[model samples]
Target: MSAHVFLHLCHEVGTSLEVGTRRDIMDIINTLANQMRTNLMMTSGSRREGFRLVESDLDVMYWPNSYRVIWELYQSHYYNNLSKELILCDGSESRPGFTLLYLLSPRLYSELQRACVRMKNRHYISSSKHRQIKCSAESQRSTLHGPCVGRHHGMLGYDLAHCFASDIWPPSASSWIDRSHSWPPSHIVDDIVKRGCHFVAIGHKLEKHEQNEWRISFSLAEQKLVYAMNHFQFLTYGLLKLILNRIINNGLGDDDKLLCSYHMKTAVFWAIQQNIIPQWCPHNLLYSSLTCFKLILKWVYEGICPNFFIPSNNMFLSNIYGEAQNFLFIRLYELYKMGIQSMLETLSITSCNECIDFIRDPSISSCADEDVLFSEADFDIKLFREVDNQGSFSVSNVQKCIQFLHIIEQMIASPLTQNQDIMLQKLTNSVLQNLAFMLPLNTYTQENKLKYRADKISCHFLKFAAKFGCISDVLYLAMYYYKTFRYTEALAIIEVIKVKLSQPYVMHNFNVDEEMYTEAVGGQSWSTKMGQAVAWNIKLNNNILYISELRPEQQSSLQNDVPYLYIPPFVMLYMLEIFAANM
Candidate 1:
């Protein structure tokens, strides 16, 4: 490579090193090997095989292929070069080729990630069955296992230098990164934060003559600047994240998290000035990702993080959901989806979908129509009031709430039964038969809310839920909304209630005629006595229907100690109407 041409490549990759810079560094590194006599033959290609260092990125192919030499090169000279650092690649084994894939700048990376996702899900409809049924005189698997299913295994993006700074790959356990290259930049700090200490110091140490001459204005906060200087090798792409991981995992300081975040945030600002980052990662997508990475972590993991620049979890999700929604980055979207799914399933939260749907919806915005949002400000104010009364919330609390919404939506969309749906249904039915006469109690506080004021809360949320197409919360919330209205809210609630009453539930009903009607022996409010009667019927006939309650010994009073009967809110309401009509 000519001296001028090398400078051009360096410029294209947005770094200071000219062509000779890398060769000088490499020749020295090769000399470090005890057996430096081995001839070094280098071939570069763009194809995803062998070893090719794209643009100015440094990648070299080794004969008698082993990863150990590359590791040695990385461990020895990666920090020293201050030019091209390592971003590992898992080379193709059968093809016997290596390629250095330059990390795409942010917008491009985000764009590519999205493209890959669409590619991944192109066949979902044909891939998944709507429902399953056993074979009708067909051999099971034709004496062969069914074809393996294809799944989407996505890509990770990082800064080359950041990735290669470590001895081993960061996010090794969580990130399915290729191990051949040597650099890393975690867009989300926590993604690689657990491995922070390992890469704490990786930068070009100033030479004696240059030490005094290198007047560094140093923009990022001290900690961020320090971490970024080392991790990013004075690059912008992955500095913020590397710094954040250190703060979060190692603790930025003994007492002050804000101060720590400020320090890092300032460092990012300074790094931006040093390198537009756009040249290497246009749109600063890595930074954008890192910007919300903390919230993304919180949204996905449901916890506050040191990376978020603030420790509060209150609006962390709202902020994260906005970024994920705005960027619509597949990597982020998938994380949020997974997070939401886990959160709701684990928390068993059945409400809040309206809020989630609203937030996740690309159309609605709490920030947009100030008049509308402000008119709704009182609602937020009230919500804050409620927030205030509750104990201080941490990151996990928000995760639980967000997860609850996600799970409810998923269940409504896709109901699963054990390993086998048909077989599971039979088991579910048998359990119903085995444990009837028990009324289920609310497990989460929201479930109790389903019991206590299922009407009001449901009514407020019903329309919005339906608009967002979240039928689960819509139907469930509408039931309570209808039940609790003062004549008007009640009437309004019930109007929508009719549409959702028959959607679906475990204890589905049919005509109850002479077979079900029994002469009543005692005076009871129809709903109460009906509850008890139904409870008894389920216990005797459908054993799986259950309600939990205080044991008689633990009861505050005998009269108040009746075992609760539990049913889906919609189901309970449906039964209540049946009794009224019968009466």
Candidate 2:
């Protein structure tokens, strides 16, 4: 096939991105149609049926109903059967492999690479050249997707060794603690494992040994300490809060719990003794400067210091960049604790409307969702059993089981219902147990729910030991700025989060169901306008937005790239509306 024909075909099949600007639509058709027409294997004697599939179809070959992969080769001008030709020409035929060989089969894999190659010049190819080849190769060599740096963004078939290694709690060092070697116990590991790692251990070629990237020198307490002792106290707090959320959402153990509470106190101790509250954390940062500036900013702006934007992870903000969630940062821990406390008291008091009046804290009173946790004279037996089992079981020790149930219940009661199976039944059977407890006072069966609650509280405490990442501050600050009409400030904060926190958050919630959004939206009833506004304002002033949409775009350029543009659309609409409304 002629080179010109191949180039023409690529124009037709490729997106505007793949085709250079100069080529028009007709050029696309001529190149692709002619190249295939000209290929001897593709041409049947006097005439032949056309190339098998359309451009829209992915390039996977099949045997009737099933997919089949085989190896074959072709030459530019030769029409002879390749097997006999191979003996005559020897390896010197130096022929290119034309994927068109599949055309004879009932189902043919799309030969995208071959078609693209046929086009004129080597450099004219799209950025995705390395990514598109669909075959397994040598262990060290991989398809050319950019380097995986963020806590998120692993290539296809990604894996993290420590994720399910049973040694998750107590580590072998090389397996669990190191960021390069292990992943935090969030959805990231689970997702990577599901994607399949085959065997992704780091290897060395030199005779002399070097440190393994996976090996962690820092203890969990030290990791937490570093979190708390950082320049941004809010970050320490945020980390604590996130860990708490993970504990509550999943489950934690005694060691994990100790890490949570201890790190917080340790952090508080270090910060106070050092007098380390900053006036503000510039949109960019390190540890010490952050705390000093942030504390000072609060004092200057509010005329008084908060007890500290501190909380167990269970009670942290929702979205790190959500405007409505900003209010959450201020006293969210208190509200969450109170919610737990109230749920506990409800179990203790067996009272309903009666409990609402008793919440002394202002934050507790403000949370509308608090009421939703307990309602219905009718108790759900199945849900109760699930919660009970998940909360406290020694052989099973459903640590955060109780808190997880509450979250699940909240998720179920919330917008997550818009989607399917946000929470799995397997999870339900474990965490949510004893439906008798949630039943009405008169109908109660279980005398005490403390075991479940205690286990959950314990687990919530453990999650603190895990590294608390940066999004906590972003959430806190973004929410604060948005609530106060400080749109520009919020945007700036989100940029910092994208730079640092995004990968961590993605790792943590990697396998999380989209249903959580439904839960957050459904149960939490977050305003679409507010969500969008917070998202966009951060985009414009900060020059960071559309990260989701830009994923495919940024991926190809990652070697030389830093994400500068790409904010969520929701943010754009919301900001514009808010700005317009005020004007």
Candidate 3:
């Protein structure tokens, strides 16, 4: 096979355009979901950057909506008389890529005040103190790792970095605008700069008052740049990451972190911007990878890995220098000399021989048949699981649900692609179900006539929910009927639920018989498959609106730390059936 064909095969094995599209869609869905919450707005980081690598970690940066950071004193005028607390970024006392956040607002949140230390008549938020406060509030399982609060155990282990949003672009990174030149285009640059940046609670390693300084994060800009990359560029980036994880960092202890994935990204970014390769195409893919690796090796040798935005900020100063840097340089240099073939061989893709065979024969398909299907199923399962976990009936929850419903309505009224329409329907289903369970709670304290009217309205909402919700969602209506002493009506619903649960394709608690599911609903639309899904557990919010019979169970759950009680669907159904029989 020619080198061009080999590179194309590598692209096929390493990257999926379909997966990238789905990831972008998932990011939008997550962004919409985060908008409903008042406390924090989340932006997904590395994991959602259109990559399907197994080594990718779930990196999320979330900032409070009530706080805003300004890069300059003059920029504060933009938020004059606003309710949000203003924080000024003061880089005079810090490094190039980091600044001390000075609290400009006289009225500060108590938590923010606690994280502030007065120095020279200015109160600066201490990154260390802020991290300490955040860690204290988190569960025991969570530990502070640099700026992020990392939880190591989960379906997808995540690193949550609590950051502050800044609407003004930093002056230090102004040079990046003109530096783009031919690549990324002017529109992409403009959009990225307009979106601004975030300040994470990490200081430059060499800063004297590290705790008082915050690092300016260009994660938003980087994400935009990644999105703007062509397929070949993206595949090359993915390939670099694979090499970083599988080749360079392999068997290295945690303390020996001389090189990181960020270095690889920066190398690629520079390579693209400098036009190191005249063309980025399948034929030139190996050349592209080689150029990036060469750049990284040179940076390591020089002991200066420049930050993409701020060139003066050396990323290698803290860890990648001296003896460590020399060792990394030698290792990378050896690999660079061995060339692209060595790097390709080190990739942990399934069966090297199979990849080689596929490359030799043009007729052999290199793509996985079930890649798209599995990706869709995975996305749906995770999204729905999040909905299930957060389901609650409270005053605040009701308000959020109402807001989310309004957003969904607005989105539905606009023009949408097929995937977007399906996404909105799933969101609508979740919000409607939340409203159904929550809206009637207020009527419990009202007069009998009002309560009767509320019960009727609640039933109507439940019916609407059942249309879009999973199969077990109807059980909410049955539970409501049983609560109202309508045993016959509840029993009828229970019988129907039993029959549905008996189906081999039914999924519950994030578990499904794979063969049965694939045979039954694998080819169906997400909405269609979800309509047949079953809720894993019946969640009852800790509220006084529960039926008298269930109050004991609710009270027991309240004694624990959690704000809700989780009853398996079958368990709840059996208990309700027995109670109805006796009643």
Choose the strongest candidate by lDDT.
3
- Give a tens-digit lDDT track for model 2, residues 276-328: 44431322222332343244324323333222211112121112224423442
> By descending lDDT, how would the candidates be arranged?
3, 1, 2
Using all chains and alpha carbons, the TM-scores for the candidates as numbered come to 0.18, 0.17, 0.79
Best by TM-score: 3
Better by TM-score, candidate 3 or 1: 3
Error of 1 at 400 (Å): 29
Which 10-residue window of candidate 2 scores lowest in summed lDDT? Answer: 40-49
How many residue-pair clashes does candidate 3 contain? 0
Clashing pairs in 3: none
Clashes of 2: 75
- What TM-score does structure 1 among the candidates reach? 0.18
Judge candidate 3 at residue 53 and give its lDDT: 60
Give per-residue CA lDDT, model 1, range 378-399, as digits (tens): 2222222221111111112323
Candidate 3 Cα lDDT to native: 0.73
What candidate 3 gets wrong by more than 4 Å, as runs, is: 1-17, 37-40, 64-67, 81-85, 105-110, 151-154, 282-284, 337-346, 356-396, 439-447, 470-472, 478-487, 494-583
Q: Which ten residues in a row have the lowest lDDT in candidate 3?
A: 366-375
User: Which digits, one per residue and each the tens of the lDDT, describe model 3 over residues 1-583?
Assistant: 2233334444333345454545545665665767666766555555667664677766778798888898777777787557788888788878789899988865655678999889879888999999989988877778888899986422456788989998777889999997878878999988888888999998878878887889999988887788788767877787788888888889988677678788888998998898888987766767888889889888989999899999999988888777887788889899988877656656654245755575446576533322333444555565456445333323346767778778778777877655566666655654565566566544343467777776777788778877777787777788878777789998999999998877877878877776777677777876678787555676666654445678887777655434666778888888888888888
Candidate-wise lDDT, in order: 0.27, 0.27, 0.73
